[model samples]
Target: MLDARLKEQLRQHLDKISQPVELVATLDAGQKSRDLHALLQEIAELSERVTLRTDGDEARTPSFAIRRPGEETGVIFAGIPLGHEFTSLVLALLQVGGHPPRVSDAQAQRIRALDEDLHFETYYSLSCQNCPDVVQALNLMAVLNPRVRHVAIDGALFQEEVSAREVMSVPAVFLNGEPFDQGRMTLDQILARVDSASTARETERLNAMSAFDVLVVGGGPAGAAAAIYAARKGVRTGLAAERLGGQVLDTQGIENLISVSHTLGPKLAADLEAHVRQYDVDLMDLQRAVALVPAQDASGLHEVRFESGACLRSKSVILATGARWREMGVPGEREYRGHGVAYCPHCDGPLFKGKRVAVIGGGNSGVEAAIDLAGMAAQVTLVEFMNELRADAVLQEKLRALPNVQVIRHAQTTRVEGDGSRVTGLTYKDRDTDAVHTLSLDGIFVQIGLVPNTEWLQGGAVELSGRGEIVTNAHGMTTVPGVFAAGDVTTVPYKQIVIAMGEGARAALGAFDHLIRR
Candidate 1:
């Protein structure tokens, strides 16, 4: 049964509906279905604009939808909109009843200008806060454009579709059967990608390009250096990357670039891009390498195909594919990722100002993150699984010097606790004593390790480490004759901007060596 007081509040919200909406509920005669039906009946009675209709069809049982009077299509509600997802139903009603969104005028214009017929199929979980952002953004786009349609699928209700799409997280948006986004994103970011992917991320047949001397597969410091080194020899060099900055964009400040006292990630990214443009490197930005086809013809040109169906051939491929942050793999971690549990301290740290937070891991990065968070959050708790902190002694001392910081060693994070909307705290257990404790905090930052982006390189038969990092030798040479890897993506020890840049130079020189001899 609905809470009496809470039901009154929802009833008042439903009373203000501007248009007639049909709550077409299809529920079985089962006990659980009966409870939902009774709730819907009670909800409908409170609002004159809403009408309830129940269908006891066995196949349609447990499925329902909200349809406007003049609309042929409506938002489907496969699962019960309880708990956090109750707000989704509330917003859906408001938007369908002709309420204007709070989007900027510029964004509205961009959305309205989308004249092509598009359908967005977004999969979401009930507890995920980030999922609502994506769902609302796409719904707003559909509301603004007549040519757009949206179907929000609850992952729990549509298990078959989720499995078929290989969806591992919430807010997995699919446009035209292609995965548009795998995680949380802002509307502006979504629009920007749409602009970039208008001609890219396509699956149509691509015209093969002529052969190139060097092909750099990443766009980080390493890949940029590889391109510069290859082009310095006056050879035809090409670079393909999904993003210009690789993982550098997530970095807030760069103090170790040498000669540069202080610079931001975007600034360094722009500089690297401008530097690459000064040369004759074939820059294929926003293009992902999906597969690497072995040389088929006598031209000795290996092929690198992109998700956009565009294929480029090169005599040599230098893989500087970067890495992504390793996850905590705890319950509620993925669901409340953007909501309160974050991996990027620089990106999401500001949101926790004046709040209490926790940082996982005791390495150099983790200690630095704790120090960073101590400035923003009222108090910072640094948790490490090891008995002793792994960070340098100086860094550990610096972190301990903070008044608002606490260090907890030999602690293992057990679960992320939340109120179904946002994270509220984190629970951990002592490794030695097996005693559990919960810290009441607003956010948790996981700063453990990094996993290389070598999944795409698997198709090319590139040798990889047990951790999935591309394995390379001293000269950055892979097992394949014309293949090489560098940067955090490789099995190189101590990943740093300087180390990556040097590796990229070596890989290019190796490729140059392979070419001059051939």
Candidate 2:
């Protein structure tokens, strides 16, 4: 089932198995089952320590389990683990076959300490770039803790289960048969949700840290650049962020980055983190800053507080909290977020295959989404609040060539329509005629724009614009002395990745200058 290049790569990866591994499949006479069996057979042939069997009794057909020789339970795949999840399958094999994981010793110990019996099931689509992180994280937890069991299910393959569960989004996770979360999450985020004591422990650890020369408050491209530049100055630097990748993790394609021909968002985020790690910066992930307290004097240290009640102090701070996807504020939008309303087209598009959907925007993102969805969705309706589309001419031309797309301009989305479990349609009003209309659809993709992550800074020490963005000077220094801001959170004109990096470097240098001349 795998090609020559893939087979060679699989062989090399499987060679790391230090213990015997068994693949047990519960399959039927279907073509998918046959293909899965062939794939397993080929995988088994790659290493002497790997073997395949057909004795699995899982309730789902075409499902398989990767386990040790004598173990009764391990990581399971309810469908073909190809595409984005292929790496998840490989990691499951290596972890189950006595290969050590790359997690920290503390993290491994915490996973082992989870004594309760927990079962997790994650629903994913093959085209989703964000599902692998969640799948691999749960698999690693299962391998580390025997009581933790996880299964990655393909939502496209089992439509019945998806319909029954009302799963309208990719990377939907369930714990103990109840909905847990329905978006991209890191391993630390998952642990923080499951383990109640994790927050207290982390807060205590962070509170004990000493003051830093430079502390960055985000982990997107801007925050990463600031930390790297500050650490390279031979000063103590610390970076705390909700996640290392930030909003970039939700992006799909990124071709405008100068010097790099083409790359994915996750790959670029990883490279940024790796490059930052090459320095002496203290990196902390999954940390959400809730409040910023500026110093009263130049010699006093500024304090940044977290939602977990943890606080870290620094001589000079760089604010690069970045931004998040803006949501349509219509009724039923929040009630059916995962049930039908989605903000990411790349992550949740495949779930609406062969179904009618609507794209709520007219910019480049919306036009590009319409073009991409025309291939899988039965029909795509592009709704715009303006009189005309603002996408590039090339993208508009491409969108016009799609046969199944319908564009409606000067239409404002009023309300989302759902049948309690899933979306059935939507309501919009025509701007020019003030006429109301509704269209039947299975999903709604919102690609409007971004809102800065500066709600915590409101009514605080820093000066903010009317739109809530941080106000900064030419040197990237904010109204508060020794506190600088950059990227989408500030009064920046553009929100490109390259612009964010340059602003971060400028802010870092500004902080250094402030420290020396004080």
Best by TM-score: 2
Lowest summed lDDT across 10 adjacent residues in model 1 is found at 200-209
**Which parts of model 2 have CA positions greater than 4 angstroms off?**
none
Cα-based TM-score, every candidate: 0.64, 0.98
Candidate 1 per-residue C-alpha lDDT over 6-27 given as tens digits, one digit per residue, 9 for 90 to 100: 7898887776678787777777
Error of 2 at 27 (Å): 0.2
The collision pairs in model 2 are: none
In model 2, state the lDDT of residue 252: 88
lDDT of 1: 0.78
Model 2, TM vs. native = 0.98
TM-score, cand. 1: 0.64
Per-candidate clashes, comma-separated: 0, 0
lDDT values, one for every candidate? 0.78, 0.93
